[model samples]
Target: MPESLKKEIGQFNVFYIDYDNHDKGYCQSYRRRGFYKISLLEGETKLFYADKTMTFKRYALLFSNPNIPYSWELTGNNHTSFFCVFTEEFIRQFGMIKTYAVFKPGSYPLFELSEEQFRAFKDIFLAMQREIASDFLYKYDVLRTKVLDLIHAALRLQPVGKLPNKEANSALRITSLFTELLERQFPIESTLQQMELRRPAEFANHLSIHVNHLNHSLKEVTGRTTSQLIADRIIREARSLLQHTEWNIAEVAWCLGFEEASNFITFFKGREKLSPKSYRNSKIE
Candidate 1:
């Protein structure tokens, strides 16, 4: 990781990666416990996670909730880049409207940007960088506005595909809320020995509903069982840690809440058709 590029300011921070002074050796990936990133840039680059290549006309919004590991490569031409990093708390404090529908899990990772829209976003980042550097009063508050403006602009520009109608069923809404809550609890750290409610019975009990009812509601909407969804998330986290971090297999296994290293290996192999180490190695290739 680039030492200077890695920044932490209280709870929220933003950084700009200028192609001019930046070096390929300094190009590195980072994994944090809880954060989301939006990348605004120009020129061609390959985003590794979604296995997609993007140009200056394309913008990338990555909704990572501390569990998913992500990285990028600027292979083609040099271009300016800006990344805004913030936690849930930072976003909530800004008082921006929450359109969870746009950022929900499994959403598409890229959006094409119009020239005018790109210019507008570029201005926002420029202002944000200025705010970060200025010694003016209430700078944080001003920065907050810029952040909210960027989010609002993206929501307005991007098409959020058909979301589950909230008016349909109250039970489904509650179930959806419960599922979102469950997802938030994940990318669970390995040191947490006792499971913090992983099973369907546990979730149902927490939600004050029967296990069958929880299962039924989740299946109705997501087309997957609760356990399956949780397992999939775990696998995603495992892949991220294996690919992005220097942590070893046993450590990675423990971090994902697996009791034994062997069990983690078996589970990962079953899902990915490769061991963690093998998968990590493949990513670099």
Candidate 2:
């Protein structure tokens, strides 16, 4: 949000945060920002992702996807970091950004870094900063290449594993289809666009399968029932809307398929142990 520290080129922007000027601490609750972010942290910090917490004692790389809600704060220690924020449209030509594992919905996007590794990434961010302020006509192209470099470097840092051989499995295929259908209804772009499939029966009907068949496939693959999975994902979206959106309880309820605000209150309290308003207030500064 600092105007001077940010350098923008098209939909991409990079920022510099130095130790002396770093704010004491701040939290950004999850919301759909429709942008991707990559940050290089150079001190102690704590990251809060959906249902997970990770601490970094020194250097670390964090990748954020617009679909996932995450936040980080300095742990009362001196910190210096550089970050870049860009929309999917900014780099769509390079590749399908979501195909990368780091930006996947249930991925561990944080990576601890050595001094050498940190400096390598820091150099890319610095180059981005300089390029954005340059007068060159094709500087945006250069920045796009630099962004890919950062992504590839982070991928290398990840632990490599032997991939399993592809095999035909009907249950797995059904589960995959179910997951796609479930994800397609997410981010709840507007109040007018209410969720149409909040139940396994509805999802099964859309997939042209029986509700029992869909439930069995999901349970076999994910070790959880279909209804449970739907509820979990709904709760996550509800939390995000509560924390980040100005829509009142009634609007949020309707957006998530609850016909009444009271029904939403009861549903939210059952899972989160607090009312939606209280959850929103807890995130307020």
Candidate 3:
């Protein structure tokens, strides 16, 4: 397959590409490090990411962090598009306050644009290009403003799905905080430590809440007990490491707080119906 849209690092490692060349099997196949892209074209294409394939239409916005792998397949060649790329630090220094929050790990990041909104975005890109070419002193600032303007416009036009109700939202907020904490201490290495951290009573004590109340809140909001959620998160992390890294079963188990490899094997088989190696090989094929 011809690699049409090769990667190029722009300002602060942001990737930029303008695909004009066409080959029979040309497609964009690569990953970005904290990248956001807005497509300004009327052409239809398929975007594959996060294990889902979706048809991308005119004026669509796609974003990915450093953690995800993504690729694109071009079905048609008649299109003109402009893209702006920048790193997380570049945006932090230049972007508005809430820009990072809007794209945080749990935040929904995809958006599709309306015709009018698309026109405005195209104008912003054009302006950015002109500014880049000139000897402007505050060109970076101009770019930052345009980027924020684009984000604000999208927020107004796009719906980030439904947030929970007020009470549910409050409960979910606590649950999210707890989940983040648990994930930070992941890959349980020893059963003793897992007991120390994964026990619902201990977690409730650390959060300064009664155990029963904590259980009730977490169950109501996430439909799972606190321990179940923790176990699931650990398993998910194990799967990621097994699939993406060349770690052996013993090492994987040790990293996840398992003292013995046998327990890890049993856990993997119980949840996945296959050993870690089998699952990994199946995915690659």
Candidate 4:
């Protein structure tokens, strides 16, 4: 965190910047703040995302939210994209987060375009660049609406099965809230940050429900127990931290909520068949 007054940043912000390369797209300066990011990108792009690596070849429409951890690199072509980022605060003022599938997990992140699709998306992005450059009042309002139009437009091209219907069912709704709450605990980007919810009961208490009820909803919807889901996600993040970061075993353990480093070592070895240090070393080798 920046100590100076000049360094404290506002929750609602936007940017249009150029990428330094395909491998790091304007990534050197920006700290992730769980913002909603939209980019109309060209070239072969790679995104290291959520324990997976995915690549887009030449022209893709991309959307991402802060709950996901990702890094973008270009493998070919100049990085030319119109990028915009806004926080949950911006969305909350005009729309509910739950209403937009664009920010949620399992949300569609890329739309591979047909020639017709490419032309249509290109118009919208060009219009965005033009309208945002104007000094007119309420331009951001127009811009916000345009962003929604783009999201809904890309959403239409997705297979109907992949899109979530209105989630009015009470059990499904509860499960959604649980999963969102669960996902919010992750992407563990900083050494100073720590997991806030480590146990099912703790999550249940925070959700104003009984532990048994939370477990039931999750199992009913996902066919997995609450503890299983939590453990799986923690292990996924553990592997990512081990492979990608220079944080030592003790620091990694502390970030994941282990009071004793030995406990983390045991938990990791049980699941991964190796100590954290061994796994990390293996990654480098």
Best by lDDT: 2
Instruction: State how far residue 57 of model 1 sits from its true place (Å).
Output: 5.7
Q: What are the candidates' C-alpha RMSDs?
A: 10.8, 9.8, 11.0, 11.7
RMSD of 4: 11.7
Which lDDT tens digits does candidate 2 get at residues 77-115?
678878888877678789867678777644568989989
Error of 3 at 58 (Å): 3.3
lDDT of 3 by residue, 161-206 (tens): 4343565555655665565567457544443334236568777888
Q: Which stretches of candidate 2 lie over 4 Å from their true place?
A: 1-10, 29-32, 159-285
lDDT of 4 at 158: 60
Clashing pairs in 3: 187-256, 187-257, 188-256, 188-257, 189-257
- Give the per-residue lDDT digits (tens) of candidate 4, residues 72-177: 7677556667666766645555766556766555554666666677677778777767776776555566766777778788778662123234432444556667
The CA lDDT of each predicted structure is 0.62, 0.78, 0.60, 0.69
My TM-score estimates for the predictions, one after another, are 0.52, 0.57, 0.48, 0.52
Candidate 4, position 34, lDDT: 46
Query: How many residue pairs clash in each candidate at the backbone level?
Result: 2, 0, 5, 5
**What TM-score does candidate 1 get on C-alpha atoms?**
0.52
lDDT of 4 at 284: 93
Arranged by lDDT, best first: 2, 4, 1, 3
User: If candidate 2 were superposed on the true structure by all CA atoms, what would the RMSD be?
Assistant: 9.8
Question: How does residue 29 of candidate 3 score in lDDT?
Answer: 34
